[model samples]
Target: MKTNESEYDRLLHDIYETIDNPCAWKDFCSHLRESVGAASVHLFGFDRQRDLFSWSDGFGLANAEPLERIRPLYRDDVRLSWLRAFPAGKWLHCGVELDCADDDDAGGTTGFALYPVADGHRCVALCKLVDHQRLTVILACSAQADDAPLAPAARALLERLTPHLSRAVRLYARRFALNADALAARKRAPAMLVSAQGEVLHSNEPAQQLLRATSLVRVRNRRLALTAPHHARLLEDIAVSEARLRSRANGAQAAAARFRALRIVGEKGEAARDASPDGASSASGQHEVLYAFYNVVVTPDDASAAELRAYAALTFYHPRSAPPVDEKVLAAAFDLSPAECRIALLLAEGLALKEIAAQVGVQHDTVRKQLQSIFQKTATRRQPELLRLLLNLPGGSAGAAPDAG
Candidate 1:
């Protein structure tokens, strides 16, 4: 419980190190509990809108207890009511929301008597809403531990730590995004993290934006999923094999694995399904959970103690579908209208007339008329001829196919 300049500086400085080494969370949680004399201290993440727990820590609690076992209690826990209504980074009572302290539900949320106590100790929580990473700090008293609220001294110490915690999360998130994007840039493919079960742990902005481009990939049940069975099977097999290898391989061994998820899709979402899976057609649009993504294993290195590491990183190795087309350049080169330029690019990408129409949200006849106009402007009366001309134009490599420059 000692507070000093050295102690404060020490934790503040290690925030980046913790992000690089998640196991640091264990140490921090243990330190916080020791400082506050709580029965148990937990840092919980939430989607307050749904009152769901995104993540929870195993500190001063039953390590073997699964989230489902505690979910019922957490849902009814009164902290949620306030969490849903509280503004960003606001320290709240963890008790009630909108004067609804008196409202009772099954999840043990009693006014002033927050339900999820540790052996009859009051559980206190404070929340900081940092965009999608809403985090809450929960403190519970043990029958033998401190039953009173956090002492002013303890509160003051925490007041110093909270802002640092939020900044760390944001920094961690940004770093993750940059890393994922770098992978995508290098492989020329969208990159994401999936659990051994293929549940998507994370994806970059490009990956999310690609979701609508094709049904081959999707995020469902908070997991990265696939609608195309062929790709799913391939991903599962690769993920499983890689997971096993990574779990056993050392850093050098993993680096030599030469592992990649091949031909998942061209252009992230721009290409047609490369192969169909057996049994179910993608046309049904049914999503199946992809099991096999994470390749976690304990490894030791001289640089530090034993730590968790991903044995394998997943990536798509394929030719990009197309580069973004510069509509203005194409139009200027071909002396075509903006609408004509868009249709020409889609046509060159090998999309059928119907597909192009669907992508552009236009009627079949509308696409036909546009095609005719484009042909007259460019002196090409057939689809193939127009596609060839469009492909040859500058800035015709790839794009969303701007309807206008």
Candidate 2:
């Protein structure tokens, strides 16, 4: 009994260590898993406002694959309805089956059914609320029998660890907040800051001018409004972008490269007709414009910056008005043939493959073949990704180019 008590105390010590060093969580969870003789131990959190997993880590599982497989369903779990007001330092033990028979919002199986517990597994978990965030820990092991109760000792250990888990997560959250605040200290200009819900918070003079001049984006009801499809994609992208930015290891350049791009097609009929492809094609429209949104963690620098914290920043690229791509640099960097360089330059100028085909007097199929070769050479799979690469290359941004004589 003394040996067991000592092991429990060691596990408790590990929880506290995680507050100062977040990576210490891996060691803690591994220790907890071994101490309890359990199949798995998982500690994870969800940001209710952002609707994304704040963080998830576990032992006896392959990465987060199991959790991610059911993430969509887990987010809408009715059992979590009590999360907002859950008592701190309290725990619950759910047997082999969860209450998942009800219909979710999409008229599909409820989130509980998709949760990680398998048919023969029993679970003991603690759930708590930290501001608008919900954190949980699940300890699962094979059930002795369908109706057998959990070992009393295992249940007691989890209950004992509950308060410590609560404190650890609260302190963990604070560390992230401090990191975000530090990132906000860097000066940014010509950038538009927006909330996760797409509400406009701040924009510099150049940014506002660009927004006003283009039909691609609009401010409606004090929020950035877009076509229904684009708006849905925007929300999805923001959640992903913010989650990646929250990682202490992800730097600005890596985050920017991973940003999802949006295509905003204009409503003008004439513009569409002029750039239309000749034969059967998959191009949505000729007047489509691309915008890449980079997530920015905004901790208000001033009162005018609003009470905003943890928002996103958008950087627009106007290919038409932007300086021409330096073909010499492009050819040198990506090893492009003269013909391929001509195609690449037009692409940088916002011309779709169909439009580029017409402009260069080549068949659509011929242009498509060249594009495939370009994609292979540059190690990109999508049009938006290739464009982002080009627009970030030398002389891509207006400031990177030489002064006009």
Candidate 3:
């Protein structure tokens, strides 16, 4: 009795793990077959919509070809009838004799047990073969039974396992429903995922082409690069507007603020560029705001705007180039004296310091000192870094590298 108890405990633990990781049901089925010393074991899940029973796993059966053959008998015709008869939440166990008279070996008779899985309108069955006094379990999502009665021990185990098994099925169903809903939403509204930073993350075919020709080209670092800076500015304005809207208590104030921001973005494309010839700058353009109709509400206490903003930033900026250096970095690194910066344009043209001195009307030594200072300040010991820094300036590359002393 102690050994049987130990085995039962082990089986229950295995079952719990299997529920946690549904992918391991096959292994659980094999373990269950061995634990029960059964001739065959199978696990099946029912698809009510498709009206089919699929094999979750099976073990210790010759070829396992007959499992599918028996499924319809248990699931479709017989099981459905049984569920209709027993509408209440209850445990069911039954044994059945199979007619094998036509077979060459003629085993003559076989016995089986049936267990029902029911949650309101949903129902399924688990079946086990009971022959030669050994119990071989197979899970079936069916509602069928034969005339034979269950053994006392088998009845007790079914009673204990039913609640846990039903809960697992309900959890699985809920997850499946959620995934289906998400998929449907993605198909219906792909553009809602676009970041507040005016970078298009996903779009339909038409929107994709429109974005590509305008400011939506991807950066070298793989972020959606806004060629038109106003797009980014528009996003910033939207963020501010959203913040303001959140502060207003009344719907009228929120609506007015939303309209103001909408009109600003609608009249001027990001960067104040006029909308395309087709009036794409208008709110009626290819992109439309879905959130405008809804009132701004604060998230749950556990949620933070900072965390959400981080995710938004991730979508707009490439992970590698995030938090770009500010203009202070350029000012400090280039050691560019204001006057030298104004007059030393010739140095970037690859001119000799003497020629730059002549252009600036300064002594050659003075020009040389300015060039050295420029190199040191810009964090570039060499002229190439200076050249690169100049090239990357907001405007244009000032010129070529200056000659070394």
Candidate 4:
């Protein structure tokens, strides 16, 4: 039951990778069951609005059965009573042996172990059960039986895995926040990603044009070559604000306040003459460095400046163009007619030929013929490679000559 370091690392790696994939939560549940030699594994996310629990993932449940069948046993059955006794918002480990009824359809009586993750506002729990004790030890949850406390070896394993588990949970939460922000940005403005140091890592078409037409220096491979002096002021302001927030006991409030102050400074400085000393004075003598901005402006349909400000505050800005492709440009680049260009754009966006045909009001064979023509002209053999080429094309015009200059 002693878990070696190499095996532990591999298991941890698998967990991290699974969580990164939005659709792999169910697989992670199965992997957890196998790694711990558990009969079954279940994951639940608390629903505060409905005041109920819902299954997030599972390993050994059938497709169509009501979860209530399994719920009643965990709620009232003597075997799982210990688990039900614990209050929410606390991590609990329970070990108990229960009798198995000979006629029971549920997985026969087996020892159980559970791990709960909670942060006051929400809770998630992972449950597992197995017939043997050695497998339980290898799984690394501390034992809570009154008759036998967790052994020294098992306790050591739990201690080692605790940090990793906590980090995994935090990473999941962070990903949720990022995805939410990205979706919001998609609705408002072109979003771009930048490194913490203000280097542009990605820009949408609109953002790229905006930066290049402005005073920013464009470098090879689509990177912006901004001098340290250019970004020094913003970096200094961020550093000072971060230092102040860190020194405060109420870090969260202080951090928010600092961010507001920085935003005001950014807005004021944004209007100043480009590369002027007045503009450079906004960051407390720190030079202007590259920064990410999510500019939410009102269109002709929306005229309220207040509404526009609200959108800007909530939306994240990046320097990227929307992912839409121009049909005329695509037709010229691939030497296709307008109809063929439309199909090619659909294919580039990962639609199957049948789906494209349905959307475009064409036969599937016609779509296939168009794809063949695209392949010949683009000299690409696979869908993935063609898609990549489309994405990397500058100005997003399919017909634009390749950047030879």
Name the best candidate (by lDDT). Answer: 2
Error of 1 at 174 (Å): 8.2
- After superposing candidate 4 on the true structure, give the runs of residues whose Cα lies further than 4 Å from its correct spot: 24-27, 52-55, 64-66, 69-160, 174-405
How does candidate 2 fare on TM-score? 0.44
RMSD after Cα superposition, model 2: 15.8
Cα lDDT tens digits, model 2, 344-394, are 889988899899999999999999999999999999998899998886675
lDDT of each: 0.52, 0.57, 0.40, 0.43
Q: Is candidate 2 or candidate 4 better by TM-score?
A: 2
- Tens-place lDDT per residue, model 1, 1-405, is 656677666666655466667667666766667665555655545443444444455357544322533454334444344444445454433334323334344234434434444444455545452545333333232223245555666656676777777776665443222222333343333456665466665565445545644555667886666646544664555455545544554653454344543334323323434344653333334332222222332232221222333332444222222335557867766688777777887887778889999999999999999989888888888877877666555432232221211
lDDT per residue as tens, model 4, 188-227: 2334443324455454445544454333334455444434
Q: Which stretches of candidate 3 lie over 4 Å from their true place?
A: 1-3, 61-67, 74-80, 83-151, 174-405
Q: What is the lDDT of residue 250 in candidate 2?
A: 49
Best-fitting candidate, measured by TM-score?
2
lDDT of 3 by residue, 1-405 (tens): 112666667656666765557666556556655543333445544333333332245554344323434444434344234432332224433343433344434223333323232221111224332111111123532222222243455445545655654555444433222222223222211122234554434343322323433333333333444334544754565465445444543562344233222211122333222347864433222432111111122222233435322112112211111222224434544656675574335545567767777877888788777777776666667667766666445311112212211
lDDT of the structure predicted as candidate 1: 0.52
- The per-candidate count of clashes, in order, stands at 14, 0, 13, 17
Residue 14 shift from truth in candidate 4, angstroms: 2.6
